[model samples]
Target: MEPQWVPSAADIAGARVTDFATFVTARTGESFPDYQSLWQWSVDNVAGFWGALWDYFELGERSGAVLVSTEMPGTKWFPAQQLNYVEQVVRQARTDRPAILGVDEDGSVIELSWAELLGGTAAFARALRELGVGRGDRVAGYLPNIPHAVIAFLATASIGAVWSACGQDYSAQAALDRLGQLEPKVLVTADGYRFGGKTHDKTADIAALRAGLPSLAVTVLVSRIGGTLPDVLAWDELLAAPGGQIDIAPVDFEHPLWVLYSSGTTGKPKGIVHGHGGVLLEHLKAVALQSDIGRDDTFFWYTSPSWMMWNFQVAGLLTGATIVTYDGSPSTPTPDALWAIAARTGATVVGTSPGYVLACAKAGVVPRRDHDLSALRMVGITGSSLPPSSSLWLRDNVGEHIPVASISGGTDVVSAFIGGVRTVPVWPGELSAPYLGVALDAWDEKGHPVRGAVGELVITKPMPSMPVRFWDDEDGSRYHDAYFDMYPGVWRHGDWITVNDHGSITVHGRSDSTLNRHGIRMGSADIYQVVEALPEVAEALVLGIELPEGRYWMPLFVVPAAGVELTDEVKARINTAIRAEVSPRHVPDEIITAPGIPHTRTGKKLEVPLKKLFQGAELSRVVAPTAVDDPALLTWYAQHTPPN
Candidate 1:
């Protein structure tokens, strides 16, 4: 495929990656003519590349080895480095620019300066200390994507306490399933949050959530939308405490900075722990170099606290970029709400999901035409694969010059393996390149690398951002079995990918939810790309189920477009398109009209869980109700199971 957009000479010269290349050449006496060569050298000389980054970023002196071990799940990075995540962020603080921009659905905006941010963080840190929260203690937040959430997280990090959060959208039971694992000593929550022009009172839910977490010593509540809870400390009061000099507690390189949870589609969500030093280094590389964001840039990603993108967006602060937090629905009052937020905030780099882009496309919403998005340098998409049609739509509607960076990684690493490179050409529906130091490749079942064909996405080398450990997994058995069990020592990320000859990657979908038919394995994303592209289809879910006697049942569930009926003609067109675009053998056994498709809170399709539901598994056993976007959809899917 031809490149949709290529970097101009000026763009290349101005990018941070180019400067880093020059720095690398000066240090190693090696010249990298292009990104591919640079990436190869980075993976080959992991220690040298990481050490160079430490020096390049001026992340203080490194006393010990850059990399102590190379073993998967055991790799030790910056073994002797004692640093604080908040310290790195504070180093970038400037008085002239705001540190954060908080926006709401009502178009209200709040600007937090670096001095005020540090002061608030200091106050909250002192309060946390008073509450007996110390190093390694988990501080959980049941809050929305607001400035206070950022303040609370920074405060937790400043005190060397591990922070974990769930969006206020989750039910109390759902919050308990994830946050209860931490047994946090301090819980920061909001009485309510605004979304879709409505106030959702979470005070009752917060009370229930607090009741379940027996380890909680104190609950601090932010009174959003005029809701109130009894016996909880007010957010204002917490920040009103006597502010002193910000105290950034130095911790070990592997000290847990925060705990992120996996989508508990199968069982209890696993608390994925990441360290302070690793996150600091990786984010500086990701936000500054690959995405080309810097001091003057205002970065905004439409994400809730539950998603890793929120964590990634917080990393923008590490680069001295002002970050924007939106605490409202993406489509509330208008389909272009997020675009408007980006424009109003003057966000240079805006990130959203593919679903939102496609929804905008279907709604005929041209962001550039409707909103003043001239400040946008890049539009990032993640959470799932970006269909080719959606990518093209963004190029035509958003801006031809602004690259649509379709990044694919997961909460597992809290960072991307392959994503945007400012100096690279933007290919429709493909990530620009494997991120520097990420030894990413597509390998067959036999462990041989393959190109132009779908294979398992594996990381052959250690990344600084890979999880330091899993909470409560003392023996390391669970962590080992999660990634390394598939390919011993190699991180087997459970996604199908195709690395084309041009070095771009296309993530198909989850390998565990693959659609296999007649000895051919296909990704569910392939079907959605073709089926959902049709004007009549709003969303699609394809399932490939193994039946008795080697027989297979493949069903395609679709949510029809608004005011459109799923007649025989629509089904026929879908079948013909699948037959031509995909394969005849992979066509669904039947086309079923559904009310809606279920997704996780972070906007991932519930493919594996729904497949388990159709395969006669009990609803309670297959998936937790609160984990889904609409729990009723699970019962509806269970009722519509295919016949034997």
Candidate 2:
């Protein structure tokens, strides 16, 4: 299974950005011989880097100071420029070209041209303004991946309002827990979402959430699941409402553009606030440079509004590329549904997480044999560290020559640390390089940057797109503790990572996800050492579960050898073998056979999502399978819970 097209040596040779001359001269009246000087300058002068970016994009400005704080923990960028983030994106392209393309689960496809998207967004913006939305007002959505989601995001950002969204698959309480923190003025949602031949209605939950939040002024519902919304306003009605041609409101560059949540480790999620100009400028660089998006490209990333990928996808608008949006599971109708869409729409870039690729492989989707993926030139992957085995499998089985980029970055930056580069060679299981203007370093605990060895991943300086503030943290105490407090001005991204000689990055899992059993700190990957190597196991999850007996006990959740039964002897062998390889604490107190491990919609083992489930909480709907499935495993675990 290989890609139909590969860049010839000539093509590769012509794609290099040898110097940062044009961008530098235009933004700063200076030019650099190479990217090294630019990168070093960014590290030495953080504020200058951000200020240059603002001018480079020619961002709209307001009548105040451009930036107020250059100090870490409260640093701000483009403080004086006032402009609506959405307005900048909307006007970036010609009105006749496509801006968004949505294909639903029922095989219905709809396209919105630049004019239509702008006009529709204007109408919705007018609707929000009329509904009393003003600067800094929070607008939230619990929706699926549809045109309306994009419409709502643009509309909210256009009006100088803060947009925050989560997936519709979230339980009523999970949605409430995150959205309530913002005290949003409006909520946009769909009636339901269809997945794996099932429909999950969100209307009732929306009503419940609205009732709980006194600040909610309106509820906008898109007709989904073939149901009518009597009380909620229809998406079309909001888009069609006559308003005297709503004008784009310009505001401060550092003004709040969006409010997103940190998937909480403790009680409630932390609301991270992103700025307008900084986010827009940085994303523009990412879309045009890293993604290699252009006016002729049709781009699609299988994502919901809940994840940061949605933010990344919408940035395609800034590049004048058509964003192909899909609202159902990739595996719906058939495992090849996404490929079919790419083939039909001629999507040049197909972005997804590594977990989805693995699932597709396990499901027997030989992409090269099953369908025509000639149009897809690149595949962007993130959400979890991609192992070398999976990366090679994709090249050998899915598509060769089509670079599989394993990107790593998150909500805080609104971009990637290391991602796809048009000129860089794609290596298996590694990120090609740190994004330009993002000074990245792999540092040991001693604060010295290191390479060819594992350490903490950190940015030695601030970037324009770092979150402006945290909601409810008036004094910025919590915000400080999250990033800066850990290392004084330097951002401590808590991932144990290694940098190769070629400057590629390899994620060794999360610093927090490391298991501590009997004073031994082991990454969850440590368990896979013996488990995956065995002939009888397809996959396994090894973690410490707190028992009612007041002790943390390790549990091995195993997907047994294919076509083999999970007998007591087989389970004993698994336990005995792991303890022998690593330590006894690494062995499981109970061997639970599961059909599949629960995972986030993005494909990361919802260690937290599953922790919620194990604690008797509702499960969020997952669009991709993250683990090997075994139906009887959870039941067996329940039967063996250490009695209180």
Candidate 3:
């Protein structure tokens, strides 16, 4: 830790604090409180907690009932309410103030004022209506981080249509895997994008995708890279369409707003359906409390259109802050591109995934030391755990006064569990506490709350932001099985973590059979499927094990096919195939050929025990899944493991 980076209180005095204890405290309010009390209040009274959040933000018109219960797992927030998500976001855009800032790879910047954004979005909404894109229709986008992407989403969401998006970098297969499930009516995308000194286009890919999805009516293209446009209508032509005034359509609070997918645990991805009012209200509250977004503030988050961070970042505008969108790799022209953009844009709050920060640290780029970050008041880190080294580096180099808030949560809830506060004390590498209104608890294997030990991270109650349903999941069986089935109605998030004595949390990666490799989240099954498919492999087991660098990396061990010999070429081929089939992150650093893979009594792979074995750590009796075969395989794996 840098000597100059003395631990200190959170940067929360000037911003809002929705709730603390029995009294609801506003930014201008006199008294202040700590994290523990606030967290207790949120967990104790879930309905009132969410209600306070809704009221604090002066949310959508309350046409229906408030809430029915705050009971764990089955809690229904705002039982009856009707509001439009896009209306809440766009409604606050006053004429002159900047609403959106877009910076491309070429260092060219485009700024859109609130008036411009609102008008353009309205026109887009009108064009959609002309195209017969109405309520319940699905409008999908495979685009980059640009103003038009935001506008398209806002417009689609405003009209009560479901908006889904994927980044341009996504492969044709990945795009089809996600978008095909939603079956969007219109496909909105750009011809190409520039990233990592490469010009990549989706023209051919989109053409192929369009052919597969019969429900797609129109193909909308926003030209960025210089190329011949396909049969898709140009963006300018649609924007040039007669600007007709369309009244913002409001809908039920629970009406479907957006549909997104998780990287599949099974073969096909799970399409998570999020609602209108709940997402808007919850996101607004999050931006206000977690990020401390203000009217005068300009917010920036480096995220691809595919990542859920895009949804989290775009929602920052609901707090009336200018959103800065960048459409290229952070290191495209230089390692300092993001900082330079933040400095130039006068961004107050800079948000990025932990991987980006670690990369910046590895590049020897000191942000505050190299760039004029005086305007940067807070730094929000997510997507992965903030390495203690990087956390200290940020605190020291960036300015000790600048709070480094490490937030955690996923698309399932469309909100955060642990995040920042305006006035609470900031701790190093600690997610201060659960966000207000979210009933989060760190429970041991026995399903009892425990402290200072890793356990299953579960949210006792359902929040407003919980996904409405999974697309095409008839009878709600998939939806129920995903969350409630684990604990019989409790929302069990598959995160292995521990809550510290100070109420802060440390995430231990996914509890489910998945690996968080270099911040690229992928299911273990993805690796196993490829590994087992090989002719040289009979069975394969993969696990994400912690490395000395304080991060998790994938390690693979496999049983050789019958009598197949272990050779360097076999290992090379397996690595090569994994990189091609999955993302680059799927390739394990070490691939060892073993005689057999360990399995439990029920024939399921003992991933946890094998993971522990690989790490040279011990655990109590493993949770034997009903699928293991060879118990002796574990002993063999431990002995033949590669030397460190």
Candidate 4:
């Protein structure tokens, strides 16, 4: 848990975080002895700290008060702010620089310059207007991770229309479940998408989505795979609407900018809405300063349109950084595809899931020796409890000089709460520091602050990017119950965390799925660390089912590597590994080898849903097909699983 990689003098000198420290020192005339001290000061003076961040990014003009409310769910900031999220993001865009670079699974790349982006957004916005999509209207996208999704979002936000997007890979019902709630007036889709060297046409899925949403007045199709829909406007036609240029709409401070869905594991996904002023300020700090993305950087994070990282990638443009996206399996064709993208694009900050990094390690991928990745200055990681070994492996196999950021946060806030800080050294298996102005803490079950022990991750103070309101949840009943129910006057984020004495935090999976063995609790990450470390296992999932009469059935499902058989020896190795690395109390009652583990489209283990399914919860109530990678895998689980 110590610092795995130390920042060089040049690295520290050039970091935007260091620059912010100097800026804060000059403004407040307070000496932040270190990054830790600066973070403490930021949380302590939340209002002044955020105001300085807004000033640092120069996100937008401020005429009124900076601090308004600090209460949970109702905390308001930037009282008189009048601006647009798209405007702040694309303000520095110019014709000279390439604004977006996208790569698909079929080895195709799409690059758009600033002028093309601006002109396309303008045309698209005009097209939306021509279709009667006006201010406060909803425009949803059942799209892939591509430049078109970005353009559609920019265009929708440009005209003050709220934007929401579902991944193209989502099943028809899942897509309907999410987009149906928003009742978008306009829907955007592509003919299909390619992943893992396979093509999937989403034409039928798109039709199904349109059928379920009665409010849709227009459906625009991007012939990404080269096909025309019967009654839809082509992507090219939308761009040829004869509009002059992008017209940024300056709405009120609290105007709804976009809607993101909660990862509805046990029930229908909640449509979490965020505003322009708040996200603008929060994303500015999270991206520009904490992540050190700027004009000189080409940033890439392998993410789908459904995940919050997609929104974060788009936020990269707020600092004039070139946004690069890859719409394919991270390990397509070979285990080196992600690293190949980094090398080919000359990406300055290469962000991906720890799953990908761990895959490279398991597959013996040494991109530093095999590929030219000299331009990769930082490896930004997230989407799970990043094992310390993965961080060290990335440094050894990719680039030793590169800093590896093991970060955490969630879709609840579109920005990271604990993640990158350029001023701090890359600590193994830990986040750098609390994101500036995020009042984060570790709380016991009774809501007591605790250190060096696992506790619930709670946010004591309101954040600018916290969900303004859940769509259709009038009277704020559901909103309060979603976050504040567990901890009075605080946001219980539902994840178990440990803030150590070393000024870093480690996320111990979701608290709901915490494993209990004879009154001893074990984080799933602990079992995962032991099982996946074995060469035979590729991925693993653990769940403890409690029954009456003090009985428990703990199952460990593992997806073995190709060509590996599920022999007794393999099971013995797994059980022994868990007993050795963790404790005997953590060993599973059974080790089942499965073909694959079901992951959310965003690549999180479907642990809670599967647990519910085992406990006799209805499939529809337990799992949303739209939220998962393969519904077929779940059917297999349901059929093969024994009754409790």
Against the reference, the lDDT scores of all candidates come to 0.86, 0.71, 0.75, 0.81
Instruction: Quantify how close model 2 is to the true structure by its C-alpha RMSD in Å.
Output: 11.4
User: Judged by lDDT, which candidate is best?
Assistant: 1
lDDT of 2: 0.71
**Against the true structure, what is each candidate's TM-score?**
0.83, 0.77, 0.90, 0.82
lDDT of 3 by residue, 1-644 (tens): 12222234333334466332324655324333665666676667666667766776677455445566654434455656767777666557676568999998888889898777777788898888889989999999989889999989989988889899887766566677788887788999888888877777667877777887889989988988866655777888888755445467878778888887776754577889888767877787688766778687889988877777788889878878899999888776787678888898999898876667777787888778788998998888886777677788787767777878778888787678888776555666667667877778887766888888888888887777788778898787888888777677677888878887766788766666656654445666666667788999998877777554456656688778987876898999889877655545678878877777666675667776667655556433443323447555555665754345
lDDT string, candidate 4, 1-644, tens digits = 45877877787789888899999999999998778888889989888888888888776566777767777768777777788888876677766668998888767778888888888988999888889989999999999898999999999999999999977766666677778998899999999888878777778778878889999898999987775567898888778755566888988767998888775543567888888888888888888888888888899988878778899889988888898977778789898898888888888998887656766787988999988887888888776667677778887888778888766777778878888777787787788778888889999978899999988899998888888899999899988998899988999987778997877888765556756443233457656756888999999888876533224578989899989998998899888877644445578889887878999998889888887677666888888888889888988788656435
Off by over 4 Å in 2: 1-22, 25-38, 44-48, 60-70, 242-245, 514-644
Superposed by TM-score, candidate 2 places the C-alpha of residue 451 at a distance from the truth, in angstroms, of 1.8
Which scores higher on lDDT, 1 or 4? Answer: 1
Alpha carbon deviation, residue 449, candidate 4 (Å): 1.3
* Model 4 clashing residue pairs (backbone): none
Point out where model 3 deviates above 4 Å.
1-12, 18-32, 71-75, 242-246, 518-520, 524-542, 556-608, 623-627, 640-644
Off by over 4 Å in 4: 241-243, 513-644
| lDDT-sorted candidate list, best first | 1, 4, 3, 2
In Å, residue 196's CA in model 4 sits off its true spot by 1.2
Q: Report each candidate's C-alpha RMSD, comma-separated, in the order given.
A: 10.5, 11.4, 3.4, 10.6
Residue 394, model 3: Cα distance from true site in angstroms: 0.5
